[model samples]
Target: MSAVAHAQGHAGQGSQALAPADPLPITGGTFKPTADSLKTYQTPAWFRDAKFGIWAHWGPQAVPRSGDWYARFMYVPGHPHYAHHLKHYGHPSERGYKDILPLWKAEKFDPEALMDLYVAAGAKYFVSMGVHHDNFDLWKSRHHRWNALAMGPRRDIVGAWRDAARRRGMRFGVSEHLGASHNWFYPSHQYDQFWPKMGADYDGADPQYADLYHPKHDEPFKGNPDTWYTTDPAFHKIWFNRIRDLVDSYEPDLLYSDGGLPFGEVGRSLVAHYYNSSIAKHGGVDVVYNCKALGSGEFYPEACVQDVERGVMSGINPLPWQTDTSNGDWFFTDGDTYKTAPDVIRMLADIVSKNGNLLLNVALYPEGNLPPESQTLLSELAHWMGTNAEAIHGTRPWAVYGEGPTETTAGAFKESAAYTAQDIRFTTKGDALYAITLGEPRGRVTIAALGRNAGHERRAVQSVRLLGVAEPLQFQQTDAALVIDLPARMPTRHASAFRIAFGA
Candidate 1:
């Protein structure tokens, strides 16, 4: 048998009896369920040049304004969210996540308005949460009955967002966090230890709700194991069917898995299917597949875009990557502190200089409106992007990432680093180079990377000007550093950009 045929035989062995209503249009490709097959993958140019994206990590979890992992966290007795749930609603034994679904009406969700703000804020692409670990589908699913259309919102949230994005000429993508759900929801089956009379079995013990809870009555509920995802073949099959349907319905330009490629060969098959489907739709493969690099041999940098959850790289990365971060908590939390506009701009410049993209999630209240502070941050970003976008969009990394004293800690969840005025990041476009100062330079700005005798300098600097300012600035190139005199007044409030022109 051929490699493709052999792979199909392996996938067919007890892999979800459920198949999509329509057959997948996989016409041509040698991408099979194997490491060698995936190694042939390559990232698209559209993603490499598009340096900024906005993500709506919004979902039913926002209904309570209670922060992230609410679905799982609410069942744990000691968690603050669980206490909030007990006070507002009843105990989990009476009310569960299923009961919280109807409250997420998304009554004020206006995708067009949000997309316009994102476009002005320099977002080249937009991503929607197809499903989080909550297992509630945001799109209208052919197989799953628990979705936005059937319940809370009574609307296809994903479809609406995609329409708005298409109208604005922005690429649309989706994120699936469902792979880790099996073990994530284990707490729902246990009863509270502190409360006396309320210590009855939670609603997850009912067999009627087993489809949603997936608890085996004969087995004991081991509340929250150190292991994250389940190793069950049955759950893998279910994931395969739901995710396949998501891909077939929306046909997104990009797909991101919250974890690494899941379920071994089953995950590889889905990835192959995604690439093939995109090739059929767009003539060639213009799609991107993003996943976390969990140090498994399966996640190769050449095959897909490596995503940092809430962090950045220290230096320039040869392959294009992405940083998925948020303004505050993943879900909207009441009275949560948010990142400043300058913080977002600085991170963007740093990531772009390292040949990476920034996918920022702006939190939205349960009613679907942004927080007042988030709105202010967006306005600030729009102003900065309007003038200095030429330095960001469609630019490549410089020979060096940047010159700086304050270095960002390189890893996931290490994004809260405080940058200074001396810290600078660089990007190049043809004959021009953009140097972004993390803060307002008070006196003179000296760039050692562009010094006269430094081999890093590509060509002689002819002139220098601030991005938003029209007047050219005075500069002196020496063996030690290229120093530029600044105007008495600053051009912008946030991070400033300086455009250095080079002669041929």
Candidate 2:
């Protein structure tokens, strides 16, 4: 079967067995705040004002030659990464993820310098990985002994990043991929189709790393073949406790979960704790939560934002949402290809135009520093943001978000055909309207959709100016459309924006 078919089959079986209830629960003090409620949730002014963010997907997984889906690779039989794991470390049973922690030497990590670079690259906020499914905390946690400071790195990773981000005048946040930890880690317990072929030493009989792998308990692994990890009640409690400690200790400006909200009631309690803690810290209400799963009817409706992965929504909503995507794989791999700077800039403009914030992009640094190619991309992005920032930051969707020939779907992880010259995305800042061209127009560009019928006249184009050019350009308005003359040569290589001043 194709990967898509496989995914669909997996989804069908999973949903058939378990019907997920309305994940959103109404907690006593947690009242749902709409966009209008004085207490109603409004996208935090800061998040709206600061349109772009960068995420650091660093963790113990970086220690190995394997990739981001280490949790999954441990189970897949005869896969290249699986084979690498067997040859290099033994089997999933022995030399498991916990044993890999000691090998993670983030020796070159410099949070201050990294945050400075991210800020220069035009990231308004920084998201540091708090804990991935590997169950290692990147912070100085009082709850979990298996943390960065206590183990491999021997430094408070999150705290350092937070301090650096704050010093650079950027909002700081943490990402918790621990929600599915219980299920994602299940494969470690059972002997998979490939497990039997492993040599005697490859069996998970090693006692030294038992704490890391969580020695098998009495519970029977469940119905889902796709769920690799076992969920022990005791381990679940520890998960919640560790996350609670993270929220309380850090009081992050934003909190991101890998999956939607946490798994069970334990997860809900953690969310409640995060909301309450934010209120307590900011003195009434201050922080924002970004969850994959959005809940309804809560005191802190505005307290959280929805995170869409690599996709833009069709229409604008009063509430703000974010798109989190990476330039390449989440973890740095030797042969990985990366998205170009233009691709990054275009994505940012497109996402912002569609009434969403782009947690724009990230590239993992295996050696604790950005590779030269990644650094070059960041520099180019900074230049792009510098020129077209007004069209991006602090802007909302205009009446209709521009006319375009190539339309992208409002679904998750959808890749679009390359946008053509006819495609233009629209955004507004104060009284100014920005029409960003996805591709360069050959002669003159005409926006016929802006006629009087659309409640705006062609005369509304008071003054037209190309973003990267110095002088204003000549333009004319007919009854149907506004047309602007172009320079003999385009100013920028890829996409460009035009600034239109209008009298409202």
Using lDDT as the measure, the top candidate is 1
TM-score of each: 0.92, 0.85
Candidate 1 lDDT over 54-160, as tens digits, reads: 99999999988888888887888889989999888788888988899999999999999999999999999999999988889999998778899999999999999
Off by over 4 Å in 1: 1-28, 217-226, 295-297
Kindly report which residue stretches of model 2 are placed more than 4 angstroms away from their true locations once superposed.
Answer: 1-40, 192-211, 215-221, 224-236, 293-303, 456-459, 489-491
Q: What is the lDDT of residue 1 in candidate 2?
A: 5
**Root-mean-square deviation of candidate 2:** 5.0
lDDT of 2 by residue, 143-203 (tens): 7778889988789989999999998889888988765555444456656554365443323
Clashes of 2: 14
Clashes of each: 0, 14
